[model samples]
Target: MVEIKDFKASDCNALWNINRNAFRKSLKKESYEEFKNITENSIGKVIFLENEIIGAIFLKSQSEVGTFKVEKFFICPKYQNRGLGYFILTHLPEEDTSIKKIELDIDESSLKAKKFCEKMKKEI
Candidate 1:
């Protein structure tokens, strides 16, 4: 069973591990560090299964863009393809009532991610 909840400061280590394992070569340590820092003040969610973190997504308010930017979204390889991505994306609005739209930049190599967004009615 997977549970989605607000990220806690104590979960930094687990979040780091999830991010590292999920985007190994495509991302660097600095990216994770930046994520940690941003999550300190931004809105985000963490995915957990029996107390172990399996994925996470961060959203930052971008007034200039007129939407919430999905700063990061990652799922451990073992937890992929289970509809968790869709679940997480759909639940973002529940966190912040002020956010009207969610925007993200998916890597061209991440076809699955692009498809997921498209399925959710989000365009590139």
Candidate 2:
């Protein structure tokens, strides 16, 4: 079963591993620092199955009107296509009552991301 929980400091290595495997581009040597930067600016979480982290996400509040933007979101490539992404999007709002709106952006070149967002739009 997929589950979401607070991300822990110990999960950094696992998060990096999953990130490296899930993407085609090789991350820079400073990727760890970049990860720290992103997570530090947002609320972070781990998506786990049993005890292993299979994915992760982060959010940053966008405005005073209760708008929240999805700052970072990823699912281990091996765990993709299993409906977990959509599940995360639809359920995020229920976790925080102050979140009256949610937003995300995808690179136009990434068909996968575009499709995912389109699917999320339909699902939510």
Candidate 3:
């Protein structure tokens, strides 16, 4: 089963490793530092499959009320190509009914993410 939890200080390394692996192809060495800085300010949630951490998501409140912008979101490379992403995206609203909308900016280099987002749009 998949579970979601609030990010804790101890989960930093685990979450960083997941994000790093997921974007290894698109991010340069220096970009990781930027990621750390950005995540520090955003509200984060960790994704867990059973007892293991599989992914994380960071969000920032948008100017529009009840809207949140995704700052960083990634599932570990080992867990990709499963239905987990769709499951999490679809169920996120259930975790917080106050969230009226979720928005994100995908990296142009990651066509897989783009396609996934498109699929999500069609499904929703």
Candidate 4:
């Protein structure tokens, strides 16, 4: 079963590995490091499957805009295309009462992500 939980500092290495493998061609070690550092101190969620870390997402408060920004979302390569991304997005509002609008910046090159978001909108 897949489980979502608060990000933990101890998850650094495993999370990095997931990030690294997920975006091999575009992987940025420094960015992942920064993400790990920030997530360790910030409020975010991590997805685990059978005790193995598989995905990570970070949220930032954008109360000024009345939205919750999805700062980061990454899933390991092996776990992609399994509807987990949609699951995370669908449950974001339940995780926080203050979150009304869910916002994210998707790379223009990532057609799959754009399509996933479109699908999520329909699902919600």
Best by TM-score: 3
67: Cα error in model 2, Å: 2.1
Model 4 ranges off by over 4 Å: 27-32, 40-42, 109-111, 117-124
Task: Point to the candidate with the largest lDDT.
Answer: 3
Weakest 10 consecutive residues, lDDT, candidate 1?
Answer: 24-33
Q: Put the candidates in lDDT order, highest first.
A: 3, 2, 4, 1
At residue 46, give the lDDT of candidate 3.
87
Kindly list the per-residue Cα lDDT of model 3 for residues 75-110, writing each as its tens digit: 999899998888877777787676677886655667
What is candidate 1's lDDT per residue for 1-124, written digit by digit as tens? Answer: 7677888888888888877777665534456668678778677788888887888888888876548888778899898888778777776666556667887775554566566656666632
The C-alpha TM-scores of every prediction are 0.75, 0.83, 0.87, 0.78
lDDT (tens digit, per residue) of candidate 4 on 32-75? 65866667655688898898889898788775754767766789
The segments of candidate 3 whose C-alpha lies over 4 angstroms from its true place after superposition are: 27-32
For each candidate, the alpha-carbon lDDT, in order, equals: 0.74, 0.75, 0.80, 0.75
- Between 1 and 2, whose lDDT is larger? 2
Deviation from native of the Cα of residue 92 in model 2, angstroms: 1.8
Model 2 TM-score, all chains together? 0.83
Candidate 2 residues 24-90, lDDT tens each? 4433233667877877778787898887799888888885687778877888987888888888877
TM-score (C-alpha) between model 1 and the true structure: 0.75
